[model samples]
Target chain A: MTLRIYIPCDAAAVSVGADEVADAIRTEISKRKLDATIVRNGTRGMLWLEPLVEIEEAGKRIGFGPIGIEDVPSLFETAAHPKALGDIAEIPYFKSQQRVTFARCGITDPLSVHDYEKLGGLAGLKKAIALTSADIVKMVTDSGLRGRGGAGFPTGIKWNTVAGTTAAQKYIVCNADEGDSGTFADRMLMEGDPFLLIEGMAIAGLAVGATKGFIYIRSEYPHAFAQMNRAIEIAYTKKILGANVLGSGKTFDLETRLGAGAYICGEETSLLESLEGRRGQVRAKPPLPALQGLFGKPTVINNVLSFAAVPTILAEGSAYYQEFGIGRSRGTMPIQLAGNIKQGGLIERAFGFSLKEIIEVYGGGTYTGRPVRAVQVGGPLGAYWPTHLFDTPFGYEEFAAKGGMIGHGGIVVFDDSVDLARQARFAMEFCAIESCGKCTPCRIGSTRGMETIDKIIKGEDVANNIELVRDLSEVMRDGSLCALGGLTPMPVLSALDHFPEDFTPAHQAAAE
Target chain B: MSQLPRKPTQKTEAGAYDLELVREIAASMKGLDGPLIPILHALNDRFGYVDDTAIPVVANVLNLSRAEVHGVVSFYHDFRHEPAKRHVLKICRAEACQSMGAEKLFAEVAAALGDSAQVTLEPVYCLGNCALSPSAMIDGKLYGRVSKEKALAEVRK
Candidate 1:
C-alpha cells in the first residue's frame, strides 16, 4: 500500500514555503519510486511547524516538520528508517496546544468533503438540523462560546435575542472585515476551511430564524474572497446551502459582499453600512443590530471566528468544549503570534495559558533574537504589556483585569529597540486615519490625541500634554460611538503608563 | 481681491452618468445614515474615483453636497482621486514590521529605487501579515518577511 502524507497549502503555510516543501516531497518520492500519497492540509496553528508534513499508516497520523524544501530528500530517506521521523506527539509545541476549534485543521484536506466528513466536519450541522431552533440556541448557550470579535459577548444571548424578535425580514451577517493589524485567523479559516464557516452560518440562520446571511469580507483578502465565493457555489451545488439544505425543508441563503479596505468596517454597524452600499460608519447602540440592522430588520451579527466555532461546539457537545478553558472563558482561542518574533504563527490554546509562555517559549523571543521589552496583546486596539506583566493569563477576564483584552487573540511582540512613544503616536494616527467620522470622539479625538502625543514627544510641556492624553483617552473611551474610538486609547495609554521614560523629552534628547 | 478662480462649473446630463446605477447603489444604501466611505468606494469601483461627471448623480441619489462627496472621496487612503497604477507597492511601517528590521529594509528599498521613503516610495502601515514579519503589499497581494532581494523581484515582476 502507498503511504499517504498531507501538508498545508494555505496561504499562511505557503508564505512560509509549504509549497516548496510539498514539491520537494513529490520529487523525493518519485526519485525513490516510493509508493506514497501526499495530501495538503490546512495549518495546525503551530505555525512554527510550517511545511509541516503528516503521514498516515496503520490507523495513525504522524507529523514532522518546520521542514523546508531543502530537507525533503533527507526526510524521505529518513522516513524509510525504523525510527520513522520522531513521533509528532512528542513535539512540545504540538503536545501543549488544546486544539478544539482547530482540531482537524492540519489533519484533513481543506476542500475535500470526504476528508471533512471522516474528520467530523458537518456532523454538527447534521445534528443541528435534527434539533429545534430553540434547542440549537440552547446548545450553543450551554457550550459557553463567546464572540471572538473582541467584544466577548455570549453567542447564545445574541442568538436568543435575534431568534425571539419577530420581523418581516431578518439577517445573519458574518463580519469578515478583519482589518486588525495583527490578525489573520479569519482569513486563514475562510481560505483553508471555508465550508465550516458556511455550515456555522447556516446553523446560525436556523437558530436565529433568519433566512438570509451575508458575509462582509474585506477586499484586501482577494484570495480568501475568491475561495469563499467558490466554496459557496460548491455548497449550493451540493445542496449544502440555499433552500431546503440537506433536505431538511428549511430555506437559508448566503452571499458574500466585499468591503473596499476600510478598517472601521470591522465594526458590526459599520460593516452593516458597507454591506448596504454606503460608507462604513459606526451607529449608536441600544437599538442594537440584533433589533434593527441591515435594511431595518433584526440581524444577528457575529465575527467569522465566532460563527466558525459554532460547528465545533455542536459536533463535540457543549460540555466537551466548555471543559477546555478556565473561569468565564471556555473553548480554545486561535491566538495569532506575530511581529518581531522567532516562532511567529497561530497558537490555539485554552484560556489559562500565561502570556509569558506564548511570548518567551512559543515565540522563542524576538526575531532579532534580542531581549523582548514589550508585547501588545490583542490587535492594535489592545494594550501594550511591559515585560513585568507577562505573567498575566490569556483568558478574556484575566486580560481585562490586567487592563488588556484578548482582542481577537492577536499578540504583537516587540523588542527592546522599539520606542513606546512612537508606538503610542502610531495608534492615534491609525485611529485618525481610519475613523468613520460619524462621531465626535473618534473623528476629532484621534487627531487631537495624536497632536498631544506629538507635543509630549517633542518635550513641549511634557507633563501637561501627558495629562491631556490621559484625559482625551478617557473621553474617547466613555463618549465614543464604537470600539474604534473607545479601544484606540488602550495601546496609547498602556504604552504611556508602562514606559513613561520613553515619552520624556530629556530622555529622547539624551538618547539622540 | 481676485476671487479664487470661481472653481469651474460642472456639466450634467441625463443618462450620461448612469443615474439608474447610482440610484440602485444608493437605494441599496438607504438606511445607513452618513454612509460617505461606502458610497465613495462604490462610486469609485463603478465609475473610477468620483469624477466631476459622476458627482451630480452621486449627490442627487445619496442626498449629499458635491463637496461632501468630494471630501469623502479624498479622505480615505483606499480611495484615490485618480485611477490607480497597474501596480501599487505598499511597504509595511507598523510596529511589528519596524521591529523586524523593516527600517533597514525600507532604506534598502528606497536606495534600490533611488527615491525617498516619504515621496516616491509608497509606504503603508500594517497589512495584517504581522506573524510573517516585514510584510509588503505588491499590486494588492501581500508578501511577508520581505527582504531587499524579494522586494526587488516582486516590484520588478
Candidate 2:
C-alpha cells in the first residue's frame, strides 16, 4: 500500500516555496524507497501554514505544515512530529469555514477527473443537463446567489435578463480579471478547483442559451492560466465541455483570454473590449451588457465566484444554498483575510459575521501584535472602518449603510501605526494610474485629489485642504463614469471620517 | 499556418531586428481572435521589451496600424520599452502589504538598491500574497515576508 501525500500547487503556496517542499518529500521518499504517491492539491486557504502537507492515515488526513525540506523525514517516520496537526478537518480554521464554492479545493487533485468525481464534482452539471433553461435560471434565482464580484448584483437576475433577450449569438463571459489588491479567491478557485468553474460556466451557458464562453484572466496569474488551460483540455477530453457535454448533445465550450495588466479590465464592458483586442476602456450604460454585450449580442457576464457557485446551487438544490446567510446576501463569501493579520487566509462564511469576529477571532489579530487601528473590508476602493465600527455585520448592505462595502470580501487589516492620510492619497494615486481616461472626474480628479491629500499631509492649508479633498471626492463619486471613479472616494472619505488625527501633522480638527 | 506577410529588407537603424522571429511569434497565433496582445507579450518575453521595429511588423501581420500597436505598448505599465535591468524587484505597494511594514521595507530596499546597476526597483499594487505581507518578486519569482537583506541578496545575486 502506498502512502498518499497532498501538497498544494496554489500560486500563493508556490510563492512561499511549496514546490521546494514537494521536491524534498519526493527525494526523501525515493531515498528510502518508500511506497508513496505525492498529489499536488489546491490550497486549503490556511495560507499562513502553506506548503501544508497532509498524509492519509486511517481514513482521515493528518496535516503537517509551514513545512520545510528538513521536516519531511520525520513526517514519514511518525504522526507525532512537531509540526503534526491531527486530522486536518478538525483544525479550527478548516472546521469553521462554510466552503460552498471552495469545498473541493485542497481536498482533490485539480487535474484528476477521478478525484473530482469521488468528491461529487460533476453532480451540478449532471443535474443541470437534465433541467430546462428556464428551470436552471429559476433555480439560480431561487438560490438568492449574487455576483461575488464587487458589485454584488443578483446573478440569476443577470442570467434571466440574458435568457429573455433574443440574439443571434449570445455569450457567457467570466470576469477572471481579479485585479483587486488583497483578493485572490478567483485565482484560488481557478487554480485549485478548475473543474468546478468549468461546470459552473457550462451550467450558465445552458441557463442563458449561450453556445460559447470566455474567461478573461489577468496575465499576472500565469499559474492559473496554465492550470485552467490544462483543465479545459481535460474537461473537453472527458466530454464535460465540447460539442456533446456528457453526451447531452448540447454544444458549449470556452477558452481563456489573458488581460494585459489593466486594472480597469476587471469591469465587464472593459473586459469585453479587451477580449475583442482593443484598449480596455469603459463603455456607456444603456444597452446594458445583459441586452447587448460582447460583439453586440446578449451576454451573461459574471465573476468567477458567481459562476463557480452555480454548480453547488444546481447540485444541492437552491433551498440548500438559500438556507445560509442573512438579508439578501445569500450563500457563502470566500473572504480573503490579508495584510498585517497574524492568521491570514481564506474564510468562506455565511454573510452575517461581524468585522471584529472576522478580524480578531479568525484572523488572530495583527502580525505586529499592535492594536488594530482600522480594517479595509474590500479592495483599494473599499472604505477603512475604524475599530469602533467593528461590530458592523459582513452583509453587503450592512457594510454599505456604515460607509463601507464588502467588495469581493477582501479584508486587509492595518495596525495603529498606519497613516490614514497616506492611504487616502494612495487610493487617488491608484485611480489616477489605472483609470481608463474615459471620464474627467476619475481622470483629473484623482490626480487633483492626490495633490489635496499631499497638502493635507504636509499641514499646508490644513482646514481648507480637508474640505477641498472632501468636495473633490464628492464630485468624483457623483460625476464619474463607473465604479472606478465612483467608489474611489469610499476609502478616501472613510479614512478622512474615521482617522482625522492622521490627516495632518498639526492634529487639530477644522472649525467647521 | 499560413505564412505571415514579412519583408526581410524591413530593417531598423539599430540593425538588431529579427523579422523572422517577429513574424514567427505573430504567425504562431494566426487563428486567435485577437493575437495582438499575446504576440506583444511573446515578443516582449523573447526580446525583454517590445522593440519599435517589431511593432510595425506585429501591426502589419495583425492588419493594425503601427500607431495602434504602439498605443497598446505604451498603455500598459508592465510592457517596458527597453530591456529591464538584470533584476526586477516588484515590491507590493498595496494596503495589505503596507499593513505589514511593506512601506518601510520598500524604503529600505530602494535605499539598498540605490546606484546598483543590476537591480531595478518597481512598485506593484498587489501580488495576491497579502497573508504573507511585505512580499517581493525578484527576477519573476515571488518571495514573501521579504526583509531588506533577503531582497538585496536576491537582487544582487
Candidate 3:
C-alpha cells in the first residue's frame, strides 16, 4: 500500500524553509525505502507551524508541523506508527477557527482539478449556471459578503449594478494586485488555488452578463502570475474556462494582465487607467465601474478574496456561508497575519474573532518574543491600534467604529522597539513616492508632509510644524483624488494620537 | 556648429507604413511637452526603455539638446536611458532593510560580484516589503524576507 504525505510550499512557508523540509522528507522516505508519495500542498495558513506536513491514510489527513529538515527522521518514524505523531485535529491552531474561503486550501492538491472537485470546488459554479443573473446576485447579497480588497463595500450591490447594466461589452475584473506590505493572502490563493479565482470570475461574468474577464495582477507577484497563467491554460484544456464552460453554452474568457508596479493602480478606476495604457491616475466616479468601466462599458471588478469566496457562497448556499460571522459582517475572511509576529500566515476565520486572539494567541505575540506594543490592522493605510484597543473584533463595522478599516484583512504587529514618529514619517514618505501626481493634495501635499515631519523630528520650532502636519493631513484627506492620499493620513494621525512621546523632541525639557 | 540629424522631409511611401507610422507619432510629440519625462515614458512603453537610438530620435523630435535630454533621462530613476538586460534586479536599500541586516546581504552580494550598491547593483529605495524585510526585485518579481545566502542562491538559479 502506498502512503501519501503532504507538505506546504507556499511562499510564506518557503520563506521559512518549507522547501528544505519537503526535500528532507523526500530524501528520508527514499533512504528508508518507505512506500510513500510526497505531495507539495499549499500552506494551512497556520504559518507559525510552517513546513506543516500532513499524512494521508484511511481517508483522513493527519497534520504535524513547524518541522525543519532535522525533523525528517522523526517524521518517518511517526509515519510508521501513526499514533506517535499525536492527533492532528486536536491542534489548538487548527481547532480554534472556522475556515470557509480557505476550506480547500491545505487539504486539496492546489493545482489538481480532480482533488478540488472531490473537495467541493466548482460545485458553486455548477449551481450558479442553473440560476438567473438576478438570483445569483441575490444569493451573494444575502450572504452579506463585502469586498475584501481594503474597502468593505458590499459585493452583492456592486454585482447587482453591473448585472442591471445594459452593455454589449461588459467585463469582470479580478483585482489580484495585492500590494499590501504584510499581506500575501491574495498571492497565496492565486498560487495555491488559481482555479478558484478563475471559477469565481466566471461566476461573476455569468451573473453580470460579462463574456470577458481580466485579472490585473501586480508585477511583483511573478509566481502568482505564472501559476494563474498555467492554471488558466489548464482550465481551458479542462473546459473549466473558455467558450461554453462545463458545456452550459455560457462563454467567459479570462486573461491575466500584469501591472507595472504602481501602488495607485490597485484602486479600481486607477487600475482601469493603467489597463487602458495611460497613467494610473484616479478617475472621477458617478459612473462607477458598474455603470461604465473598462473602455466605458459595464464592468464588475472585485478583489481576489471576494471573488474566491463566491463559489462557496453559491455551492454551500448563502445561509450556510452567512451563518459563520458575527452581526453585519458575514462569512470567513482569510486574515493575513504578518510582520513582527511569531506565528504568521493566512488565518481564515469569521468576523467577531478579536484582534488579541489573532496577534497574541495565534501569532504567539511578537517574533522577538517581546510583548506587541502596537498593531497596524489592514495595510499601509490601516490604523495603528495600541495594546489597549486589541480587543476590537475583526469586523468592518467594529473596526470602523474604532476608526479603522479592515483593509485587506492584514494585521502587522509591531514591538516596543518601533518608533511611532518614524512610522508616521514613513506613511507620508510612502504616499509621496506612490501618489500618481494627477491630484495636487496627494502629489505635493505628501512631499510637504514629509518636510514638516523632518522639521518636527529635528526639534526646530516643533509646535507650529506639528500643527502644519495636521493641517496638511486634513487637506490631503479632503482634497485628494482617491484613498491613496485620503487614507495616508490615517496611520500618521493614529500614530501621533497613540504615541505622542515618540514625536516629541529628544532635547525637550521635562514638564512639571 | 554641430549639424543635427537629418529630419524626415516627407512621409514614407507604402510597404513601410508601420515604421513610418511610429516615426510620425514620435515626430508629432516633438518639443511640445515641458520635459522629457512624458516622452521618455511614452517611448519606453513603445520599446520597453529608451534605447541608444531613441535618445537622438527623441532629441530630434523635441529639437532639444542631446546632452539636455540625456541629463533629464539620468535625473529620474524611472527613466532608464539604456536598455535593461533581459532581467532587471533591484535590491531594497531602504532603512527597513538596513535595520533588518540587509547591509550585510548588500555587502555579500557586492563582494561576490565586484560591485557595490551604487555602481552595478541597483539599490532601490523600497519595494514595499518592509514588513517582510530584506526585500529584492528580480525581473520585477518581489522576493521578501531574504538573506544573503538566500539571495545568492536565487541569483545563481
Candidate 4:
C-alpha cells in the first residue's frame, strides 16, 4: 500500500516556506525510497502551524508544521517528530470553529473536480438542477446568508432581483477582489477548494436567469487566479460547467478576470466599470447593479463568500444553516485573524461569538507578547475597538451598533505599543489614495481629514481639530455616493471615540 | 502615507515599444467582452509594464480613445509605466502589516536597495496573506514574517 503525505500549497503556507518544505519532503522520499505520494492541499486555517504536513496512517491523518527543511528527515523516521501533532482535526484551534464555507479546504486537491465531488461537492448545484429557479432563489433567501464582503447586504435579495429582471445576457459576477488587508477566506477557498466556487457560481447562474459568470480577482493573487482558472478548465471538461451543465440543458459558463490593484474595484459598480475596460469609478444608486449592471444588463454580483455560502445553503437545507447563526447574519463567517497575533489564521463560526473570546481563544493575543491595545475589526475602514468593547458579538447589527463593522470578517490585532492616532491618520490617507474620486467626501474630504488628524497629532489646536474631524466624518458618512466615501469615517471616529487619551499632548510627548 | 505615488504623464517615447507584439497581443484579446482591461494586462505581463506606447496600440485594437486606454493604465497601481528592475519587492503596508512593524521593515528595505535599479521596493496595501503578518513578495513569491535579511537575500538574487 502507498502511504499518502499532505502538504499545503496555500499562499499563506507558501509565504512561510511550505513550498521549500514540500521540495525537501520529496527529496527525502526519493532518497529513502519510501512508498509515499504527496498531496498538496490548502491550509486548515491554522496559519501559525503552516507548512503543516499531514501523513495518513490507518485512516487518520497526523499533522506536523512550522516545518523547516531539517524537519523533513524526522517526519519520515517517525510520526513522533518534535513538531508532530496528532490528527489535525483534533487540534483545539482547528476543531473549535464550525466551517461551512471552508469545509473542503485543506482536505482535497483544489484542481481535482473528482476530489471535490467525493467530499460532498456539487450537491447544492445538483440539487438546484432539480429544483425550480424560484425555489432555488427562495432557498437562498430563506438561508439568511448576507454578503461577507464587509457590506452585509442580503445575497438572496440581490439574486431575486436579478431573477425577476428580463435581459438577453445577465451575468453572475463573483467579487473575488478580496482587497481587505486582514482577509484571505476568498483566496483560500479559490486556491484550496476551487471547484466549490465554480459550483457556487454555477448555482447562482441557475438561480438567476444569467448564463455567464465572471470572477474578478485582484492581480496580487496570482496563485489563486491560476488555480481558479485551472479549476474552471477542469470544470468545463467534467461537464460541471459549459453550454450544458450536468446534462440539465442549463447553460452557465465561467471566466476569471484580474484587477490591477484598484481597491475601489471591490465595489460592485466600480467592478462592473473595470470589467467593462474603463476607469473604475463608482456608479450612482437607484440604478443598482441588480437592475442595470455589467454592460447595462441585470447582474447578480456577490462576494466569493456570499456565493460559496449558497452551495451549503442548498445542500444542507436553509433551516440547518439558518439555525446556526444569531440574528439576521445567519450561517458561518470565515473570520480572518491577522496581524500582531501569536496564532493568526482563519476561524469560521456561526455569527454570535464575542470579539474578546475569539481574540484570546483563537488569536492567542499579540505576537510581540505584549498586552493587546486595539483591534481593528473589518478592514482599513473598520472601527478600532478598545479592549473594553471586545464583548461585542460578531454579527452585522451588533458590530454596527457598537460603531464598528465585521468588514469581510477581518480582525487585525494590535499590541500596547500601537498609537491609535496614527492609525486614524492612515485611515484618511488610505481613503484618499484608494477613493474612486466620484464623491467629494471620500476624495477631497479624505485629504482634509488627514490634515485635521495631523493637526490633532501635532497638539496644535487639538480640541478644535477634533471637533473639525467629527464634522468631516458626519458629512462623509451621510453625503458620499457609495460606501467607499460613506464609511471612511468609521476608523477615524472610532479612534477618537474610544481612545481619546491617545490624541493628548502628554501622550504624544510620552510616545516621542 | 505622505507621498501619493507618481502617476504616468502623457509624454511618450513611441519608438521604444515593440509595436508588432503589442498589436498581436491586443488583436488576440479584443474578441473577449470588455477587451481593453484584458489587453492592457496582457501587455503589462509581456512587457512588465504598460506605457503611452502600448496604450495607442490597445486603444486602436479595441477602437477606444487613447485617453481611455491611458486612464485605465494610470488608474491601477499594478500597471507599471516603466519596466520594473530585475526584481520588485512589495511590502504589505496595510493595517495588519503595519501593526507587525512592516513600516520599519519597509524603511530598512528601501535604505538597503537605494539607487540600485537591480531592485525596486513598492508598498502593496495587502497580499491577503495576513496570517503571516509583515509579509513581502519578491518577484511574485510571498515570504511571511519577513525580516531585512530574508527580503534582501530574496530580491538581490
Fraction of native A-B contacts kept, per candidate? 0.37, 0.58, 0.08, 0.82
Provide the DockQ value for model 2.
Answer: 0.42
**Ten-residue region with minimum lDDT total, candidate 3 chain A:** A78-87
TM-score of chain A of each: 0.94, 0.98, 0.95, 0.99
lDDT of 1 at A247: 86
Show model 1 residue runs off by greater than 4 Å: A2-5, A19-38, A53-90, B1-76, B114-121
Clashes of 3: 1
Question: Backbone collision count in every prediction?
Answer: 7, 0, 1, 1
> Which candidate comes out best when scored by TM-score?
4
Q: Each prediction's Cα RMSD? A: 7.2, 3.8, 8.4, 4.4
Lowest lDDT 10-mer window, candidate 2 chain A? A503-512
Candidate 1 lDDT for residue A207: 93
lDDT digits (tens) for residues A308-374 of candidate 3: 9999999999999899888789999888777777767777888888898887778887767777788
Candidate 1's TM-score: 0.87
lDDT of 4 by residue, A126-177 (tens): 9999999999999999989888888888888899999998888999999999
Task: For candidate 1, write residues A63-124 as lDDT tens digits.
Answer: 77777776666666665643244566556776788776766666667777777778787889
TM-score of chain B of each: 0.68, 0.86, 0.64, 0.87
Please, what are the lDDT tens digits per residue for candidate 2 over residues A1-512?
Answer: 88999999998888888999999999998999989999999999999898899999788998998898888888878747999888999999889989899999999999999999898899999999999999999999999998999999999999999999888789999999888888989999999999999999999999989988888888777778889888988898899988898999998888888777889999889888877777888889877999989988899999999999999999999999999999998998999999989989999999899889988899999999999999988899999999999998789888889999998988999988788888999999999999999999999999999998988877788889999999999999999989999999999999999988888666523311
Two-chain DockQ for each candidate model: 0.21, 0.42, 0.09, 0.44
Candidate 2 residues B1-157, lDDT tens each? 1121121122222225588889987877766756677677767667777888888888888889989988888877667788777778988888888888888899988887787788879888777788888888887687788888988887776
TM-score of each: 0.87, 0.96, 0.83, 0.97
